[model samples]
Target: MNDTSLKANFLSFTGRAKILHMTWFAFFVTFLVWFSHAPLLLAIQESMGLSDQQIKTLLILNVALTIPARIITGMLVDVYGPRKTYSAMLVATAGLCFFFAAATSFEALALARFLMGFVGAGFVIGIRMISEWYPAKQLGLAEGIYKGMGNVGSAVAAITLPTLAIMFGGEDGWRYATAVTGVIALLYSIVYYKSVSDTPVGSTYFKPNKSGGLEVTSKRDFFFYLIMNIPMYGALAVLTWKVSGLGLLSELSANIVYGLLVAIYLFQARQIYNVNREIFHTPVEPVLQYNFKQVAILSLAYAVTFGSELAVVSMLPLFFKDTFLIPMSLAGIFGACFAITDVLSCPSGGFISDKFGRKTSLVILLSGAAVGFFAMSQIGSDWPISLAVVVMVISSFFLGSAAGCVFAVVPLIKRRLTGQIAGMVGAYGNIGAVLFLTVFSLVSPSAFFMTIAGGIALAAITSMFLEEPKNTLAEVMPDGTIQLIEVH
Candidate 1:
């Protein structure tokens, strides 16, 4: 089908298209609930008599759980399938939202916010679902639409929740607004569970051959997997250090958490060994082998793409307010334009990948992103505000598109292992956020932008090593028959 026909068919509410829409909406609602509190932080702080330190703690707690949760959710989706996994996550996050809304104390609210981080894992579930329904030719656009639209949830929350709070009209308006998100989450959980299936009719839903950790096809890949896992734990440690530096945890508690992280890494390494131990003694069949370099490179690329996105989105409003001498509201509007572009930019990246090639699209997008950020770093008070906004919008387009391009290659890696692969890649985005945000904390905005540009330059170079997906990827069936899925 031509691209125009495929896009027109995307509007129809039947077959694979329906699944695509349903899954993306499911992801959207989860993100809406996940970020519902961000735009209402002032209201939350005023109503609760919160100090700046306490509010910062709440922000830290919000993302602390997501890194590990994505890893776990990936494993569960691979084991239980997206239908069940997505539904359960929605239901659980609804409960957490309600808990957050009803909290009467800082401790209760912090715990609820921390637990709500798991809602972010909902993105990985839909990835596997979309991969199952769409062919390789259309997979990039489909996954892009799913991710790009779903990502709008955060922007939606930013745009709508404050207004909803005002409509409720009281000191507790934020609470009521938050409760509304919870109620919607509760209703949609049921809607999603009843409406979606793990795979299309007559198609097999591939599952991982082993559980606990991702199964690598060779000893070298096994060691590479372990090395890649280090950054995730390191990111968690950074969060712990940040929190401790803020005096949220005692030094003793911080040390204990550090020890716990080390122990967890050791345990995870053992799990990886247990899952791939056979590779130490016997070589995996050539047909089943996949390069771990693909996963590593994609992870690094996403750290630059989506990771910088999260960090930038969090700081952009402040950056504009301080640099451009704008009102908070107008600065927020400018900042929001960055995320809003995801609706178009992400799908554009994916379509470009579908029409051109994955590696080519990513390199071009990342290169543009590098240039965009470098330009942004040069902005100052003397620059026209409109020009600055244009620069930011351009930077956002390349960054969001690069993110879309990264995921376009994810589902093509290994059919049965798609969830785990998406999980690791997604987690790296968080790791990138933590890394970049840390740099922002220690440097000026210009320096921060320069650092991100440098990171993108590195990612663009690393992406040069990426091998595009071929025409077919082989998977073994229950009866030992080889099934080939079209990938190119």
Candidate 2:
């Protein structure tokens, strides 16, 4: 189908599409509640007499748990399905949100904030769900819309939560504002559960034949899987070390900490087997198999796109204030435009992928992103701020489109294993965030932008190997009957 032909795909009502919309909305609320403290940090710091280092720690604590959360949640999602799992997570996090809002002491808030980080894993669950709902030809756009819209939750928190706090009009205004978001989360969990089914009611939901680790068909893929898993665990370990402030292990207890790390690693490796073991012993029919390379490619693509976006948002306000010599308020306003672009551009990218070919669309977008970031890196201090803003927006569009394009094919890889695939791919996005943020910590903004450019080029090269959507494939039902499905 051409771009115009794919236009009709968006307007039609789909049970899976409705579920996609609902699932992300819940994800959106979780983010709002998750980051509510950020906008109100000043108030919180003043009220609690928090030091800069302590507040920074709290900020770090907010996302520190999400790496494990994504991996663990990926396993559970395959076993339990996104419907029950995501709703349950949102509801539980809502309770945590209440704890965060109600906490009077920094320690109490810190604990609550850290635990709530699990909710950020909501992004991984929906990836599997979207893959199930759409055919392969359109999966890119469908996944794009879901991720793009849900991702706006971060921007929403940044833009609206502070205004909400002010509207409530008191020292406790931030508290009241936060509680309201939590309440929305609690109520919406029920609505999400009611609005969506795990799959079409009559359609069989395929389950992984075994549980614990992901099985690979080839020994080579098994090694590749192990290699990919390293970053996920390493990211977690890094977060742990960061929290413990253990540069030399002088400030924290290393023995207990290393033991804790070992325990988590064993648990994660076991989970990898749960998803992969069956694929090793029982060879899938040739038609049902997907390349591990595809997963690796998308993971790297996400590392560059979503990964850089996350790191950029975290630093852009500082980038703005320092480069432009603007007030904090003005810098914040300039910084926010980067986020707003994700919402519109993400869906647009998805739509483009659905209308055009997924691989074709992705290649074009990645190429655009490479150029965009390269330009951004070259922008000197004497460059026009408005021109810089224009450059940033352009960069965001390419980045968002690339995200839409990456997910477009996620579901088409393995139908029964969609959850695990999405989980791994989604985890890579987090891994990207961890990787980029780590790079940012070590390098200058110019170097950071250049690193991202190199990543985009790598992803584009991988995109060359991807096969475009072909309509013939078989999805084996729960009953063990093969049903030929049209992917395009």
TM-score of each: 0.98, 0.91
The sequence of per-residue lDDT tens digits that candidate 2 reaches over residues 153-246 is 8778877888988898878888888898889888998988888878766666777676666545565687688788878777776666666662
Error of 2 at 194 (Å): 1.8
Residue range with the least summed lDDT across 10 consecutive positions in model 2:
246-255
lDDT of 2: 0.79
Q: How many pairs of residues in model 2 come into backbone collision?
A: 18
Estimate, for each residue in 1-488, the C-alpha lDDT of model 1 and write its tens digit.
35653453788888889999989999999999999999999999999999898899999889988999999999999999999999999899889999999999999999999898899889999999999988888888989999999999998898899999999989999999989988988898899899989998889988999999998888888999999999999998999999998888999999999999999999999999999899989998898889999999999999999999999988999999999889999998998898899999988889899989999999999999999999999999999999999999999999999999999999999999999999999999999999999999999999999999999999999999999998889998888899998899
Error of 1 at 50 (Å): 1.3
